[model samples]
Target: MDGVTIIDHPLVQHKLTIMRSKDTSTASFRRLLREISTLLCYEVTRDLELTMETIETPLMEIQAPKLEGKKLVFASILRAGNGLLEGMLDLVPSARVAHIGVYRDHETLEAIEYYFKAPEDVVNRLVIVVDPMLATGNSSIASIDKLKERGARNIRFLCLLAAPEGIRNFQEAHPDVPIYTASVDSHLNEKGYIVPGLGDAGDRMYGTK
Candidate 1:
């Protein structure tokens, strides 16, 4: 809770509810994720520093506030993270994108990274990591670790849903990175699934098992 922000906007809540329903089709779920991500981006970027710039309007010149920092970088955690990435990009088209591919080793339940690619100047940008679900926190933590290894200092984690266990682990692992989610679910089930969550977010969105 210290470094986490739960986005409870009306539109975000409503869309989350629909995503939780078992009857919701894959296409609908994907569409809702994209829509909800736009709202999440709004909150995440609320405190960005702005600078006044002189600009010419039809009749006169005026100073207008504009973002005054390096371009943002959206670091997505593999296939599922892409769902949130697409929508966030819709809102901030200029933001750069980084892809981190990690998966849990079924037996060991350990996160293994197969691929990682980030912007060349990650140190100068605000890196926002996107993932649909924060369950065990293994993948999320590993992704951030990779980003930090690549010179990223300013980072934030964004997800559609989160579990108490996952949040605790993430906060403990990276206290500086703030987390944003639509809902913090009851808890994670035995198999590492968030209880009352929208099933497997990647599977639901992409129709994979």
Candidate 2:
């Protein structure tokens, strides 16, 4: 709760409900994710620093405000994370992108990394990690760990759905990093799935199981 922000905007909530329904078509699900992500981006970037620059607008020159600092990096956890990535890019087209591939070992429920790529200036810019579900927190923690290893000091985690267990675990592991999500579901099922959550975000978004 301390390091989390729940985006309860009506539009986001409405779209999430449609996504949860099992009857929704794959095309609808993908489109909804893209739309909801735009709203999430608005909230997450609310506090970005602004600077003034002189510019001429028709009649006279006046100081105009522009975003300060280096381009922010959106580090997406592979496969499913890309679903959110597409929409976030729409809002911040100039932002740098990073991809991290982490898979869960079904039996042990541990995260294993297979691929990772990031910009050389990652350490200097703010990094926002995107994932669809925070069920176990293992992947989220591991992915952030990899980022820190590469000198990333400022980081944030964003997901569409989260579980109490996952939230607690993620906070304990990375208290400095804030979390943004549309909903914190009731709980995680025995198989590490969020209860009442839209089933397999990756599968729903891409029509793949």
Candidate 3:
């Protein structure tokens, strides 16, 4: 828990409860995911640097705070990560986007990368990698590995839910990148699914599987 931040806002918790219900419809689940994602995005970027710039008001000139340095890069881990990506973009419209296509091999739970695209200027900009569940940490860790290989120095990981095993694995693999999530569930089931989780986030969101 040393490098994890949980977003416990009332609205976030309320929506997450609904999302956890098996009775929830796909449309409702998708809507709640987008709404909760916006709230989570707010907490993840809370410490962004700020600079002051002079601006003219209707009657006089004033200095206003503005974000400093390059715009943020939201590196989505493909498919399910895009669920969080949509709402994050709603909050930070100017943030750059990166797509890393990686999937878990159901049998081995190993991450396989088939596609990757990111801004050429990822050297100094902050990159936040997103996925709905961190059950095994394989995909998240592999995605960050690709980002770092491309010269990304400052990075963070964001997810809707995380398992203790996944968190420990992620921390051991990439301690430098902090994690943000709405909840750290009890544990992962034998099939690599988060116990009591809202099922497959990607499937629930898109009505797939």
Candidate 4:
């Protein structure tokens, strides 16, 4: 509640509720994810610093504020993050994108990084790590580790939902980075999934499961 932002905006919360319902169709689920992502993205990038410059308006000369520094680099945590990326991009169209893939071993439960790609000038840009569900936090922490190795230090995380265990794990591992989420549900189930979560995000988004 204090450190993490739980966005319960009417639109965001409403869309998320629809996403949680079993009756919601796959098409509806997909559309809601994109809408929620767009809604959440507004708050995430609201604080971007700006610089002033003189511009000529139709009426008269005016001062305008332009965003400062290198553009944002959105880091999508493989599949689920991709769902969130489209919405974020609608907000920051010029931001660069990065993809990182990690899959957990069903038996061991540890995350394995399968692929990683980052922008060439990632060090100078703001890295926004996005994943729809933050369960266990192993993938997020591992992704951050890889990003840091490649010169990304300033990072913020965005997720559609999260679990307490995942947030705790992430904060302990990387205290500097702040996490943004639509909701933080109860806890992880025995199978390492968030309880009452919208279910496997990758499968839901792709109709795979």
Candidate 5:
């Protein structure tokens, strides 16, 4: 838990409860995820550097705080990550986007990369990787690995739910990157699912198997 921050806002907790219910419809689940993700994004980027810029309101000129340096990058880990991506983008529309396509191999739970596209200026920007569940940590780790390989130094990981096992694995693999999640669940089940989790996030979000 040293490197993890839990977003426990009342709104976030309330929405997460509804998302966890199996009775929730896909449309409802998706809507709640987008809403919760915006809150999570607020917490994760709380410490972003700000610079003062002169701006004119209607009457007079004033110095207002603006984000410093390059636009931050949101590197979403494929399909499920896109759910979180949509809402975060809603909050930071000017932020750059990166999509890393990595999937966990069911048998080994290893991450396999199929596609990757990112901004060429990643080396100087803060990159936040988003995924709904950090069950095994394989895909998250692999996606960050690719980002680092491309010269990304400042990085963060964001997820809706995280298993203790996955948190430990991800921290051990990439201790420098901080993790942000709504809840760190009890543990991972035998099939690599988080115990008491909302089930497969991608499946539930998209009504897939």
Candidate 6:
């Protein structure tokens, strides 16, 4: 779809296939999740702003560009988001990390925040809210709302996969923030699960079963 980033890297696609297989072992699943996230991290940070400065080479000095500002505050939306967070850290080792835990109300389908914390100067820094699944967007929206309350206007949503309905809902609610996903599949199922999604990101990631 337009305005959506569906990463089509061969490696990502291949790993996703393995992750999707019910026969895959938990160890393999976890490893692939990390690998895919690292790949997506490269794509997600491609547009980050940069400034040029003089640098010294062995022979001489030359102007070069490096990442600027306060680096980034990656606010992981708990358990599942941690999957992507670890990989992101590998790429942005100096980035500040925070946590905000939110859960879904099975009956009401509303997001409930049980925990929230952030960096001291989160607003001035580039912020990224990450979770692997953007199912109904409630959690992402709520997490963003909390971050905004703390003065985080500059933000991005990173998900490994998304459902069209959730994407629409999130875009409508927070039109200002852009979303990044490895893939956006079809509509959600009757029970609200994104069809063909890697089932229950939290459960899958943690081997809760």
TM-score of each: 0.98, 0.98, 0.99, 0.97, 0.98, 0.95
Better of 5 and 6 by lDDT: 5
lDDT by residue (tens digit), candidate 3, 164-202: 999999999999999999999999888899988889998
What lDDT does the true structure give each of the candidates?
A: 0.93, 0.94, 0.94, 0.90, 0.95, 0.87
Answer with 1 or 5, whichever has the higher TM-score: 5
Per-residue lDDT value at 72 in model 6 = 92
Give the Cα RMSD of candidate 3. 0.7
Considering summed lDDT, which 10 consecutive residues are worst modelled in model 2? 200-209
All-Cα superposition RMSD per candidate:
0.8, 0.8, 0.7, 1.0, 0.7, 1.3
Task: List ranges where model 2 is wrong by over 4 Å.
Answer: none
Best by lDDT: 5
Query: Which pairs clash in model 3?
Result: none
For candidate 6, write residues 1-209 as lDDT tens digits: 65677888999888888887777777787888888888988988898888899999999999999887777998999888998898889888999998999998877778999999899888898788899889888999999999999999888888888999999989888988888888888878866787798788778777887
Q: Clashing residue pairs, candidate 6?
A: none
Each model's backbone clash number: 0, 0, 0, 0, 0, 0
Query: Where does model 3 exceed 4 Å of error?
Result: none
lDDT tens digits, residue span 1-209, model 4: 54688888899988998898878888888888988999988988889999999999999998899999999999999888999999889888999999999877877778899999999888899999999989999999999999999998899999988999999999998988899999999999998999888898878888888
Q: What are the clashing pairs of model 2?
A: none
